[model samples]
Target: MRNDVVRLGRLSGERSGDMMHFLSSMRADRYIAGADILVDIAHVLMLDRQKINDRATTRQLLPALLRLHDKGIPEEVFDDRFEDVHAGIESLLIESLGVEAGGRMHMGRSRNDEVVTCIRIRLREDLIAQMTALLKVREVLLTLSENHTESTMPGFTHLQHAQPTTLAHHLLAYEQAFSRDFDRLKEAYARVNQSPLGAAAFASTGYPIDREFTATLLGFDGLVTNTMDAVATRDFALETLADLTIMMANASRLCEELIFWSTSFVKFVIFDDAFCSTSSIMPQKKNPDTAEIMRAKSGSVFGAFSGALVTVKGLPMSYNRDLQELTPNIWRGMDDAGESLRLLADMLASASFDTKRMSEEAGKGFSTATELADSLVRSCGIPFRTAHNIVGRAVQKGDLSLATLEKAAGEVGGGISLAGKGLTQKDIDRMLEVRYSLELRKAPGGPAPEAVIAALGERRKQHHHDAELTRKKQAKLAKAKEHLIAEARRLVA
Candidate 1:
């Protein structure tokens, strides 16, 4: 029975069921199962359009395909006897409609062109979803930035407090990084949106096929052009995983910071209880397990990108069975990235900052020292390097008070007179204040409250622009899908 379905009596060889199952990709089969059905529908529709198949066969074919779509592919569609879902689906089609009608579906395409087109169709939607998730995260960041325009915190370098910056400023930095990620996915979307249908087994079909018509119905932007490259190329899959890795890397950095900020020693921020987990033994432990897991996912995504690149790197291509191994990487990587964005956005939207702790820590490491030096450069005639030396000595000497700073400044000579070349006590008091420290910054991109507010306005504009861009593409795809279904249903009606 199995050999009759899998191979004709014309071939004498038979494989053990164990070997068939071992070589089977049933686990990976479901990812493209729906894609296979859609590809078949589009190809059948195209064949009918080009007069390659009679109207009666197509009329029966379209409604039958839609019924299968409605009921969903059966569990037996993953049966190992067919080797993969593509063959399994064809067997199901043949079973449902019999040989004459079912056999015509494979006339002008191969599993090669069909699978690539399916991957593209599914991946296009996933990328849009990923961007949409990121946009939500970006909105959360913008809201956080707005609420904390003057909320001062210690900004760090090499894990040491380096300067005073607002929580708004720090969050905005991530907002911008993720904006670039949003942009990269948009860019990759353009390339991944092309169709590979009609590239039958690395050669153009002799049949008068309408590649563009199939592309339009499948929601693809255009065709993959060259018949050989269309089916053989895995770069689109590779490009998407690589793009996802970069996005995850950025998320991991934010997650790592959240882990540090939530630590008892820092106490700069606290995760929402829902996003945190308690230790198995320690009842008081509110660990940032969510962030840690997402952070670890960054490495896993990177591995996926690397694994795929190596798989396709040396293959002498038109198409190879080895390409089947690459599909799981794309599917798994996309799943990892999409979930990470959704969870990270949720985790951040409810997070709270310890303003007093952040403010207090902002001053402990002489973070306001730069503002003081800048004051010397402005209020006094001393050169910046001399002012730098004077302030550096004051920081090192632990003479952080108004009175002591005067004495320290007088003692640390750069051969420049301190009598008139440094700030007064009044100036010192203002410069030493963290809020005042933030207010003194007037540079366009500086961490000052007004500057952050201005930057926030600009980012909100960008957020709006990107959201519109996403909506436009989404509308295009939605229309294409509706058009495809409408056309198929039209023929049968």
Candidate 2:
């Protein structure tokens, strides 16, 4: 009791001006918290099992962990006496309890396993948070795609107008990308869900530790079967970054299109100013700064991915100091992914498409040249090659006005039996009706109104199903967390 009072007083005194020092050494805190708790738990379990237990010694040892757990040592308390979090924790234990009681808990564990476990827990928590944010982004995208199901926009090939497509098709392209991201993360969970418990310092503990129980206690799905692999490999972190890199690469490309679309020249859409920004000197500029920044910072996630790869490269490791360098890099990439997805969701929610402008431009710039060529084949019985050549020439020539086009149609053949009984100038006019042309393309995957509506209906059903599944998974995770808190409280009680 006297020692407990003294140690608590010492901790309180060190916390006054040293709070900055402790907060800055955040990794050290994590290590201390992790190592000390594991050691204390092991000691308690061991002492309880001994046949001729030393009551006084057990009494003394219990305080080492209890004191540290209750009142952790401030960073200022250590100068040159400790080497790392492991040493710092043990050294504090010795200072609080006598060395005999403090030293017994170090029997079958190593700081290598301790530090790795801490990172694993941190990663699991972070991944769940990131996945939730990604789900929100996907939900917003789905809503936009449904709302714009029939809104026509010019589809491009080689940056030139090729055909007409609905805005819903464009939005669903991103939904598919995000859906794949979700699957990738879920796949990664199978590997990352394993625990490193009982892998003491690159080797299995000789002590009869319940590794499975501890793993379950930590909410891990299983234990790492090979003890050496548990401490040596950081492939889980690499896999996560690889997934983030691929997903962000796709997102960056989409943001590039958004940047292009929001421009006055294309005028496909206008982003709300709340999701955009103004330049310092340019008075009339509503810069797509949010989208631009998303495109730019997306590269930072890639950079962090490369940085972690380099950190782990060429290291034949049981464990090395270089592995510690990966913590910030892993977390930095995750931060970028989380924030980028949030920004994308907000932009999607607030942006408005200029359907009239998009639809108007959808038919101009010789966009109907394909329709004209098709008419030649279907009506004049001309070979497709000859039809393509004729339309291509007509498009290049300055005499391709609507009036000129009708006159030319008569010269080609006013009443050929190819398309029907009589192909006329009126048929050409009807073919040029943008809505009619689009509606006439009633094939399964075509941009016809019926197809678009059907696709929208299917996607909405999928979204509802996916959203319900996500809700169920979230509920399961919440229940697990509640169980952990209850069990931990029981252990203390």
Candidate 3:
């Protein structure tokens, strides 16, 4: 009999006709058993209700499902037996208990509703975890931005030197990106927080299941409004994947910078030796492969996003097998995104910037042209076009030193004067100050140091608040799971 069971299980795929025979043959001696948590809840409700109250049926089937659940049949058996996890559990229950008793388990719901509910529950927890990791990355960026605000580096346009900006300013740009990402997640969370439990199959169930209560029990904000939409839509998945795609893309941009800055030619950043790789042949090679890998892996995430979109693109107004394939991609993308965020935070936190080198590099390539242009406008009453022409000429001469160029500017341009508006040489000097340049444009969203600092502080605070909220949500999820597990154990025990 053992030899027969082994042979039956190993039957080739060409024996497709024999697959059912294989399954039934293995179950000849031992009955297959499974359980659906929602079904159990429904059974209890049925027993409590006067119309469907059947204690004997509940007693017979509920305990059997619970017993099988305790006996530890592999989860894969459920997948192999029925169309889905929920059905597999029910089939197992029917096999263990009599068909009549098992028939009562599915009181008022379809797998359409149950499957969506289970995925939503699972994904809610996953999204919370992803958000927590994102917050950690944001915190690191914020701290780095604040600390490096004064550390000047060459800002670029078209991959060429454009101006001198604080390393803090550049870091804060990413901080801003992450802040928006966090906001996107908050918006996504609103949609994800809704429960879809009572929308059984494609339509609402007949059971008097209090959806609001189930939603509250599941820590959801409310029940999904429309039954068909609840089961058929994967918008939550799209929103999450979109946000993650954006995040991974942004992170990849940062990685590109890291890789460039760590290169021998630039050497603006020095990554930790631990995060570096070495060339097989080159004796002196210390490659920043960690950052490079991150930069490269972003494409994989985009592919995941594309795969999901294509899967759901032409599907009709109902659930389909195509949607089933989306789960693995979603899971993979989320895992990759979370890991990328974690690695990036660690890399950014420990990496060193060559401040002196950056400052030296900052003044080159005529990066201070805008500063000179502004000086001409504010001091000499020169029109912007005139000032711009004068500054461009000075830059063409390859002299970036403001003092030398200021003298040169005075010598040229018919010896322009700042007599009006009581503008003195000292005021001219003040206008030349980079901090002044940054601070003067302190509109609500300007990159002034003060503004950047304020934004950093606020973002840091919000990050903590968000993280705490996630923790509370996770705790609620755990408590709910505990309640469900306890209830299942009680019935079985």
- Kindly list the per-residue Cα lDDT of model 1 for residues 317-367, writing each as its tens digit: 699988888888898899999999999999999899999888888876888
Top candidate, metric lDDT: 1
- Which digits, one per residue and each the tens of the lDDT, describe model 2 over residues 443-481? 865777788677767766776766676566566656754
- How displaced is residue 99 in candidate 3, in Å? 3.1
Compute the lDDT of residue 400 as modeled in candidate 1. Answer: 59
Please, what are the lDDT tens digits per residue for candidate 3 over residues 1-493?
0112112345534334355444431231112122245335533544434346465665576566555546765554444333345555556656656457765676666667766666666667678877887888888888888787677678899989887677877887887798787778777877877887777777786667667756765567787889989888988988888988998899999999889888888989999988998988998999999888888778878888899888999999877757776766677787788788889889988999898888778756766668767776766678877677666766667664455455545656556543443556566556555566666645654556776677777777877888888788788877865665566456545
Error of 1 at 392 (Å): 1.4
RMSD (Å) per prediction: 1.9, 6.2, 6.0
lDDT of 1 at 448: 90
Give the alpha-carbon lDDT of every model.
0.86, 0.69, 0.69
For residue 118, give model 2's deviation from the true position in Å.
2.2
- 10 residues in a row with least lDDT, candidate 3: 25-34
Give all TM-scores, in the order shown. 0.95, 0.80, 0.82
lDDT at 270, model 3 = 94
Residue 471 lDDT in candidate 3: 84
Q: Name the TM-score of candidate 1.
A: 0.95
